[model samples]
Target: MTDKRTTAPALLCDVMIQIKQRLRPLESQEVLWDQAAGRVLAQAITAPVSLPSFPRAAMDGFAVRSSDLEAASPEQPCQLQVRGVAYPARPWPGTVSVGTAVRIMTGAAIPEGADTVAMLEDSEVSADGQFVSFRRPSPPGRHVIAVGEDVRAGQVVLPAGRVLRPQDVALLVALGLTSCPVVRQPRVMLLVSGSELVPPGVIPKVGEIVDSNTPLLQALIPRDGGQVVEVLRVPDDPVLLRQAFRQALTKDIDVVLVSGGSSTGDEDFCPCVLAEMGELVAQGLAIRPAAPTGFGWLNRAGTLLPVVLLPGNPVACLVAYELLAGRIIRHLAGRSLDLPHCQRTAPLRESWSSPPGRLEWVRVCIEQNQAVPLRQRGASSISSLVAADGFFLVPEEVTLYPAGTIVTVYLFDTLSGQQF
Candidate 1:
């Protein structure tokens, strides 16, 4: 266990890899383009047809040859016909050739004979319906959208691994994509096991704490694009634990997370349950506040469900999510959790210490451009994280940092409105 302190992040990272290897990137399904934003693409999507499949009008004006406008300025005017030149749709073939022009609206298909567009502002309609006049020369392709200008027919408009945004949805719609291929959201089962835990809103009769991990994990999992298929808060009863675990697995769930009961505490039944069910892949990571995090495989009737066991402490839970579950989620979503690309520099506003073994995840806030440590340090400080702005990692070699030391603050949440 002591050796794990130095090797914890790596060991936890290995557990992340192990679970990721067992789980599959979600399957693909068709979702309406308008509703597809924030969903991951299952496969590479190429344009079904050339965007602007036909040369189309980009403005509500007359389609005319550029040469007509070349000579005509505000002083000089060019006259064209309304009937044969432009119509609501493409006029007859050879309708507006060379000197001729057609009236078109925005998004209307360009006529076969028209090569340019003359804006209405640059032109005026005569007293008669057959006559149109423009004061300026229209350039070639003016106000005209060229075929395939937006997306080529065979082009990979969006490659795989694209997280659909609102703008992407609009583009897909413009390309006539009613439904898009999106990776299926994995169903996650979050099970919190503790005998000393009470449900929320329950009056605490001394020594009883509400089980915050259940709700926190339930919310966190779905935020990563996975569906929380089940949430169970069973006491330390082994029978109830097994029953709840089985129930969570009974429904289709991709991942199973048993919260708390990982340490060598008196009522820790999670390890015993793992032994009775299947193989324990790894147990007891060597890290502060989250040292008891565990991971293993649970076989129920020969079906293996990758299980991630995190410590009961709220901070430990967060760290487990970052180093373990978060990586798996990012990987499954076709992303990488590499060394975060960020400035990583902030001034420490407070002092903290950890033994020279585990990397300390110190929560701090940036005040007046300074990184200030939060009020909590031990594993049980639940309220301390709420007051902090961001966190920084103290390498295993470090013991403590005095205030005013310049350190790299690796932000996990939205500190300074940054994603890093």
Candidate 2:
């Protein structure tokens, strides 16, 4: 029996909306503070105690009463006795009196009755080591870090749904938290099917080639916050493909990725298998280089798992994964569904043309503040992606971009050698 399917491709925006409506972030779990980086916070964190919970010296100076130095200047320096010294974790035993100053180091606690700190450079110590003189008067609270200056108690330092950074881990450690509650990473199962494909390090016969999609997806899955739990290689045979799909669904996984057999060729069986086993929400996309991408929901016991079908062509597989599968994985991992790239506006170096009614992603390299389109633009050309620095999209209604037109380029990596 022939499988019936929709001929018209679904709009990219509409398919994304459907995915957002169906997928929710996974449950939360506790992880050590060191492992919390790059994980989304599932709960808000409040400061239990204020940062720098004590009044401390901001620099190496003497703590003094502001009134003692108010009328003192270079001509008439104020002479005060040096009572004691204060070091980090060691506070002066006595308070600062009306005519005495305490020698303090940076980050040391200020003594009681002292409201100002005079820098060592601006003060002179007597040869007898019994007295210190201030040449300039300092105002009250000068060079002093007051209580709760950096963060106050009961303040929310981190909120839910926030993706933690390396600096964030430091903040949590400073807050005295050993562990943090974060959304669990999504688990993924990959099924790569192609009879003409061979594994890496294997010599293929005349009609076969190495399977690149499996390794590509394996690397990409974790980069997008999902963990690859299993990988299954299936041939073009329908029974084996169905068995692999069934086996993947039975395992504990949040999403399934089928890397080949998504197009309309005679050997293409992903769309048909998915339709027979579950509901195919979208069979094709109205986007260039990845129009054969498909999305669906599979029922595992009582849970519905999201599954994506990526094209067999290397470039198309990458495009479809970044635009569709990546978003789904990020959503389940409690991360933003937006594209993970830095965008910059630049003028086109040459005129570019595209067919109307389909959105196209054009790869280009930034040259002297201009977006220069690459020459290798085929779906199977993986070298184009490597040679290009970034890409810009042409909207469905627009057909042509004239030379020197300002366009936004989404960088594959950051412009300043930083990762987004």
Candidate 3:
């Protein structure tokens, strides 16, 4: 009978500040370097040994003294005795003398007394394998990788808080690291509360819809470096919702996400339950499509678990998750707090308008390097997101963006399908 919506909605910036102030990264754990990709580094990794610790050939070449080829030319080719051959794992035991050369493969240790490597293409070896002839002068250090050419011992190769990529894993392996210290992934519990919702496999009857939020969150949680430990579908009843909240807190959860029941409707009980169980820090964000978004802290044992109350609408739920829940999860996983989107400044293909006081996320398709605003702007339009390549935010103060206005579009697919 009473409207409980806050007349003055909290700014998105304020809510984000509160969330960051209360949460911290999870404890670090040691995992094998082979399994460290996509995990955030918990500590700085210093190189124990220099990469290419020994002087090695950078290409398949003949290791020879630079002075021997100093006067070699097309008209007066230089001839040198072939001392031995060197492979990557097998180095030539003998040294390169003034008139001799060692046939060396890439990555093979450079034979002693050799200051340059004449590429195999530039040298001709005799059929008898006794002598090699070069027509071009070779410079010192040419085609040779000196000791510590790539990484130096005791140098910080990977810094703390960095998400390990495939290349990063390779570097760690090159550094001779068997295991790496990475922040543990944040554990999450998803609670989808609605009476008219059915599981994904079930065919929804009249007035009932398939619960898409669960699957959406399931996919997104891991993308933001979170592990969903439990998922529960709660009815609209406040009692059951409250029980679900209690049960989620009992588990080892870093964050609890409640999709639906966040608005100020009669069945909307998430805000009340949060207030009763812990402290409701934010409610009714000043953001379009996700205005009912709420944030709170639940005291479980001695820890304060973050609880995000997202609107039931599929699009609204997604927006809230991207702006709030995703940030929380990434922070707890020791990753950057920035949104996992590659942003690019592009001009709008058409004019767009938003409410003067609410931040709006406008789904747009990139066409001809321009952001084309979609027609489906409803909070429940999942199709809009499906068709969108990215979205752009309109500031709370601005109401309209004229056609061709430059705006930053956050791309959904970039940097391995996420943030840059």
Model 1 Cα lDDT, one tens digit per residue, 33-152: 766888888788888899878888887888776766678867778777675544446444555666666768788778766788788888888887677888877778888899988889
What C-alpha lDDT values do all the predictions have? 0.73, 0.90, 0.90
Candidate order, TM-score descending: 2, 3, 1
Q: Write the per-residue lDDT of candidate 3 for residues 267-339, one digit (tens) a residue.
A: 8988888888898888888898899999888898878989999999999999999988899999899888887
TM-scores of the models, in the given order?
A: 0.84, 0.95, 0.93
Best by TM-score: 2
Error of 1 at 202 (Å): 2.6
Which parts of model 3 are misplaced by more than 4 Å?
A: 1-7, 69-78, 121-124, 415-420
Once fitted onto the true fold, the runs of candidate 1 whose alpha carbons sit more than 4 angstroms away are 1-10, 20-23, 73-76, 84-94, 97-99, 124-130, 246-249, 301-303, 332-335, 338-345, 350-353, 397-420
The residue-by-residue lDDT of candidate 2 on 1-420, one tens digit each, is 157476799998998898788778999999998799989999999988898788999999999999999988899999999999999889997989999999999999999999989999889999998999999898999999998898898999999999999998998888788899999999999888899999988999999988888888888888789999988889998889889878977798999999998987788888988988898888899888899999998998878899999999998999899889999999999999988888899999899999889889888998888899996778998889888888998999999999999999999875457332
Q: Model 2: which residue pairs collide?
A: none
